[model samples]
Target: MKKYLHTGILIVILLLSGFLLWRHSVQTRVSHEVVRVADVGAIAWVPFQVGLEKGFFADEGLSISIVSVQTGDESLKALLSNSVDISLAGIIPYSFVALDHPEIQVLALNTFAKDNQIIARKDSGVSRPEDLIGKKIGYSKTTASDIGVEFFLKNHGITKGQVTLIPMKPFAMPVALATGEIDAYSSWEPNIINGKKLLDTRAILFNDVLSTYTWHGSLMANKTYIESHHSSVLAFLRAWKKSAQFTKDNPTEAIAIASAYTKIPAEALKQIWSRYDFVANPSPEEVVSILRTDLLWANLHRANPLATIPDPVTLLANINESKI
Candidate 1:
């Protein structure tokens, strides 16, 4: 009787341990959905995918829901409304950030390639940046690319007064430039490649400064989300950094991933992805520079009637310390 009682107690203990472990296991599984802009399109978007495919996210105990966003503004709105966890976008988020949402920060650079450039036809007498004077140039409406293109132009002494700025998608830039409807377009590949294919269409001057500007393809997160899910964020970024590392180490596979995600061919991915530095570091000055230029453009164009970002530094999201 004594032996049987002892065995029963031992069994109960074992069963409880097993059940507790099972419960813990069930509770530990975390799955999250993330959204990015459809136009944030490129190989740079690879880290999110790498985190998914390589079991990196699982290792960090996180699952990401990567989806397409309408644009940068949409991504932030989604973040604000708690629709998604992170936004992979250009510096466009700077346009919306203020004292209201200091938590929205660029966690990592998704990609660093100058996928965008100024494409023009070989003829029609448009060559130097100054040559764009009195010519119709294509740009986007209230976008980071638009702001960047205008800054690039002004820095080169080609003001909007001299160049007619038309709004067009980077993909459609080739068509607009090819059809002679527009003189030139500031865009990125596969449109860059497509634009050049248009029977003598070429880049008069490719703005490599686009890369130099330290503009990032960012992994944006909110403060509330970070505070509640600190572990989740760390796991996500760790997986992300690993994904970034994987992108550097595995070019062929990375190209395939980039091609698959962007739907650009592997050859095109290879050409463009090679040029951009795919690091995870977020540069403060780059963000500041982009914001200052954009704010000026917003002021110059009067893009915002009543909007005022009192402190651009607030956009950087300063916490007591970096939470990596």
Candidate 2:
């Protein structure tokens, strides 16, 4: 009789263990089975991080998993390779896509004309686009910065032959310019701010140089992923919009959050943050303008401007003002 009771107890224990394992499996599946996202480590993605930290994505019944990429170009590669579900890089890749593919649709434009200026050495005798010729021009990746420099120089009548373009990262731009390793590197802040102290020249209106330029650091998803999870895409966007509103409402706290992501000091970020005003659905005209320039610039740079550019109207989202 005692042996019979022992066997019965062992069977009950096994059944209970099975029940607990089932519950744990269900919870784990529910926790992360939504959307997978990726972001380049830049200030452009501050709002997305803020939303995740504040439970904004969770509130939308969505789960966004992010992986850090070294640069926007790498992020695009990840999205294309299916390594990441989505990309938070700018529309620069869209330009190459437009010429051929634009598989990644630009869902929303978060910011534009954010202190993306070109500075010069105090005594470099370089003040305008005209002054850039015969000088070594520094640009990184032949990516977004190269596009900016191309337009800035062309509008000033400086051709490719007039200047030398060297590839350098954004942070490295300040040192390259200050050390005079290159005559003028297309500088973007916080490098621009640092460049001001290192190099000695005043900026010559790099912002809106192509007034039609739309440097949108937008949300993008692959066609396959979006097809399978349409609701997930909408939910992520809803969460992102809420974070944008939070940024507008709490400008100070927003800076602290952005400061954490960028690793620039909070005090320094406060000064930089004031220059940019982030938003969603930056007009269609803005998208067209930037695409036109990026494509033409890429053509000149020997990069393949094919396999991604799709129709702008189909890609951009027109959110209702009243809906938000």
Candidate 3:
């Protein structure tokens, strides 16, 4: 009887040990949450790239796959079509569709900068703001660059009738100016940077008008995604916060990461890095104010004449600060 009792006790201990080991293994393993993000490969998105390269997202148990697009408008489109879980884009793009799709939310404002400029050809006699009066100004319509150009002309007392506004893709603006397809173009970096390089001594940049406006680069998601994946959204925001601090603390390393991700030269990124404010979250009031102004402009210029302008307050409600 004593021998039988000892054998039984030993068997029970062995089973318990196996169970404990299995439980430990399960507890220790991480199930990564996959997040698909659409981005317009801009320098403003450096923090996101930094977060990816530095393993910050991994720390949050997130596996991020980036979908590159050419413009913020395209980024928003990807999100709307459900092709991407999140989108990194500008305030202008979000504002354009905010009324139609009230479900889309701005998760955070990652970048705020006055980075747009009007690149003109000196040979075309655009030496100053007034010189742009009769010149053909190339700009990407329905984008932030459009607003920049409009504000620029307004600031310089140049009427739309005085100058011909030509619609062109942002990437093509520099080459168009170089080839004399347009006398001047309004765009942001690295297009602005490239235009100067292409024109060399002939390129002149006007930034004073753009400096009055601060452009916002934001992270956005749909209401359904936010509701279903609240924890994931919070995790992303936390990682972004860390990334922003890291970028500010380590400028050289951040520049290298951005340069690699954007394919822009490191020196050029470093030159404009100081201008970008990589804040993970901005005050809701400030965002609302900026959006209100932009919405007014869109109503007057971009929106359909019959479409009712959505109240900026309604748009402000979509700013998800709970995660921030």
Candidate 4:
């Protein structure tokens, strides 16, 4: 009889353990799923950081892991290699690989404005594009900075041979200018802002001169991920949109977040934030127009010799702006 009792107790314990295991599995499934994002670590992605810190992503039942990279190109590479689910990058590098990777889709555009500029030392006597002749100008090769310098020179009737091009990383540009290593630099903020503060430099030209030029800061993802996890994509974008609105509504707090995450001075961010249009969704027409201009520039400079421009309309999926 005691043996029977022992057997019954063992059965009870086993049943209880099985029940608990099933309950735990259900709980795990109900919990938020992790989504990896490759971030370029640009101040333009301040909204994403704000969203993460404020529990916006949590509200969507999603947890985002941001992998920091130095450049947008690096971010794109991470996405292509399956290291991350999404990439935050500029339009140029995004376009370079867009056609090749049909799986990659630009989920949304955060900002569409002129952020690239050509800054010259106040004492360099390069107040105009013509003055850049014979001057040593520094730029990050194959980036918007380089594009700006090339476009600026061409518009002002200056040839590439006229100026000495100094290839340097974006971070080193300001110091190079201050120490007379380069007379001018083609760069974007917050480096531009920080460099100007550290030296007597002024912006001689901005990319806005090209009416067709649009500096697009975009969020992109693979189509497979978007198809399988449509709800998650919508949730991410919703959180991002809310954070962007928060930046506009609460400028002080927004700049604080930006300054802390990017290590950029709040004053500097405040000065440049106005230049960016933090829209969650950009119209297809606008994107196409921007890509058209980018393709033209790429071809003119013969940078991507093997890359043939695709029809701008075919570059992206039929993105439902409603989700964004």
Candidate 1, residue 290: the lDDT equals 62
* Alpha-carbon runs more than 4 Å astray in model 3: 1-30, 209-212, 303-308, 311-324
Per-residue CA lDDT of model 3 for 18-89, tens digit only, reads 999999766543678899999787777889999999999988878998898877888889999999999998
The C-alpha stretches of model 4 lying farther than 4 A from their native spots are 1-30, 123-125, 200-214, 299-308, 318-320
Preferred candidate (TM-score higher): 1 or 3: 3
Work out the TM-score per prediction: 0.75, 0.74, 0.86, 0.80
Worst 10 residues of 1 by lDDT: 30-39
Error of 3 at 294 (Å): 1.9
* Residue 202 in candidate 1, Cα distance off native in Å: 6.4
Which is superior by lDDT, 2 or 3? Answer: 3
Error of 3 at 143 (Å): 1.7
- Candidate 4 scores a C-alpha RMSD against the true structure in Å of 6.4
lDDT of 2: 0.67
| Top-scoring candidate (lDDT) | 3
Question: What are the per-residue Cα lDDT tens digits for candidate 4 across 1-324?
Answer: 999999999999999999999999777656988999998666677788888878888877788887988667788889999999989888777766664675688777677646677778768786666787999999876567777677677777989999999988888888898888999887666666767777733544443564113367888888888888888888888888898888778888988998998788888787777776775465678777887777666555554454566777765655566766
Badly placed stretches (over 4 Å) of model 2 are 1-30, 123-130, 194-214, 283-309, 316-324
Number of the predicted model whose TM-score against the real structure is largest: 3
- The local distance difference test score of model 3 is 0.81
Single out the weakest 10-residue window by summed lDDT for candidate 2.
205-214
